[model samples]
Target: MISPEERNRTGRGCLLGNWVEERATTSLDKTGPESDIHKKGHQGILTVDWSSKLEDTSTQKSAFTSSKGTSAQQKGFRYELMKEHLIKSISEQVHAELTAKPAAAELHSVTRRDYTAGGFQWVRPTPSTDRDYKTDQAITFWRENFDKIQGVTAVRNRDAPFKKNASFTCPITECLDPNPENDLDTEEK
Candidate 1:
């Protein structure tokens, strides 16, 4: 009594449900192909063609071999088919298992502003001179004042405050002190 559209939808839904069920129940082994085939309730046999589903036919054939030389072709066919079926079923199970779990918590940005300055600095010592006395004295002066020059350079290269924390008040409103004066301890008069 169902309309054609309704029947089609129901059929598709049933097919999907059966496919999922088959993927879940199928054993991950190539021992037998007949065991992998499922019979849907009153909806005909669902014969999974594992060999045809494989992307590379030659690879599949080369990966498996049969002991029976005379009937090798037939045995190889069944073996490849069963192997593909087992691989597909196992992959589906793993995919389902991975997707079922809750997603990992998102990482929050931990970036903070560098308030204090005066970090370590490295400077290449100026090349010394062997020819002139005045030039050698100038090089010696440069070598002696290198640390002071480096310190000055460090002060000049201080990192600018992050835009989010540029204000005098605390960036986090909840953690802000009600009386800002209490933050700095005063000597008892």
Candidate 2:
């Protein structure tokens, strides 16, 4: 069977494109006055869900950037993206699992009150061998999903509270004291 891209190359993809186009255009061909229900059914469902998810991810990314990420246990894009990809795959798997369940079957789940700081943490089933070399594949994945992560910061101190350069004692007092050679009093202080 020809893929969408292959079909498009031969100009036989009109029907597939039309189907997708029609789904998108369903909301625009409205006859009656604007109603929330109609909008929700046609446009709101996919648009609202996707946009809100993207927005949340964007916010997390912005927050992460302003704050620094962990240094010691710093994970590279290869590991992190692999984890993210696996997560997406597992979630799709679970969804598929649930979908496969009989209509009348009851679904049961255990509930627990968790206190983890970061939310999107996932365990990798398969680990990469080379831990030294900087791989382009991981970096590419990082760049691609960098925007999707809401709170994955590139900054140095992700946990450091937003300070206007307040002269608080070093967060890790035992390790080192917070001091600067050039005491340029910025607004953050």
Candidate 3:
């Protein structure tokens, strides 16, 4: 079967997923009150009931980010959350950002350092002969170190673009004097 992309491009084949909607709300929902009750028949027989009582929707609503993301799109970013060191420029900036736009901290989560850090990016075994390399130098480095990078020794899904679910992505990255140097001020964990 021809995909949606081919159908859209060629303009000759029939497509089932053709209709596009500006607004996703249903006809019944748009007509009147937006109550939680769901009716199946014409007599308005209630077909659904809430399993758990929701006193407030604040927790659920905070999970969604309404704003369209920024220029830091697709790029891996490093941000600092201010707690102890108020003297640093980035820490002060982060606090200021949260103060000005409180909604910026929505969907914020604490993650493990080793899991998300780039230092642990290539922990898997060496790539097989079937895998494709991004570049000659990259392949050479991988083969020598027995390390493989994504979209090179491994495949990356090319369907839809990946997006960060967090709001207010600050492009600011604070490094010491040099980009490669580690901060000497950090305490031992």
Candidate 4:
């Protein structure tokens, strides 16, 4: 549930966007709300965890910056209880469609930070002016969010160095060469 603080900040034009990408699970009670809800055996998922970090080099906001994080803006929430319900629900839906498979649930974090910032304290994005996010980043967020469930592996942001983080994925780009001193990894090169 959104809080009073969230409402106030959002009213001031600082919006909140939350997204999730979890692997599909085989546990009946784990997928949507359960902590292990996204345990994989089926495929994957899509959801929001929006922020404003984007493709800016001046303010140093790179496209690699995440839009989602622990939403430490809400005051009080029953994460465990909600997690339980969410897992059951997502599990039901996934299995209902393909009765042969199993699933579980988990809730995205509603926990908030101590300092009050814009709704979720999302970093002001490159297009800091883009509140509604007309048709660019929001669209990419929507597309990438869905792509996870579609079983599409994440590709590296070629402009960014190959590295890993707790949030986004860049599994295969580690071998790319920054200079011609090393062999190129793909035909595109």
Model 2 vs. true fold: TM: 0.16
The list of candidate 2 runs beyond 4 A from truth reads 1-73, 101-189
Clash count of each predicted structure:
0, 16, 0, 35
Candidate that scores best on TM-score = 2
TM-score of model 4 relative to the true fold? 0.14
Residue-by-residue lDDT tens digits, candidate 3, 1-189:
444354245345434343222122233334443343234322222334446454565866778758886767563333233423445877779888888844464453556533466555556777766544553233344444432344332111121112232223533352123522232223212
Deviation in Å, model 3, residue 80 alpha carbon: 51
lDDT of 1 by residue, 1-189 (tens): 444345344354467777576455434322334334333231223445544543456876888877656644655678999999999999999999988978898765553234434684668987584456543333355455544564232111112111133234536685455765543333211
How well is each residue in 1-189 modelled by candidate 4, as lDDT tens digits?
444345234344432441111111223333344333335433222323345344437455553576776868554468867988999999999988987655565544555343555755467558645355453333345454543455443334422222343234434465443654323344237
| Ranked candidates (TM-score, high to low) | 2, 1, 4, 3
What would you estimate as the lDDT of candidate 2? 0.53
**With candidate 3 superimposed using the best TM-score fit, by how many Å does residue 83's alpha carbon deviate from the native?**
40
Residue 24 miss distance in model 4 (angstroms): 65
- Candidate 1 ranges with C-alpha deviation above 4 Å: 1-75, 103-189
Q: For residues 1-189, write the lDDT of model 2, one tens digit per residue.
A: 434345334354467668676556554535344454345545554565654644456666766666565577677769998999999999999999988956785454443334445576778777566454453233355555554667553322322322233334436555343643223234236
Runs off by more than 4 Å, candidate 4: 1-56, 59-75, 100-189
* Best-fitting candidate, scored by lDDT: 2
User: Ten-residue segment with the worst summed lDDT in candidate 2?
Assistant: 154-163
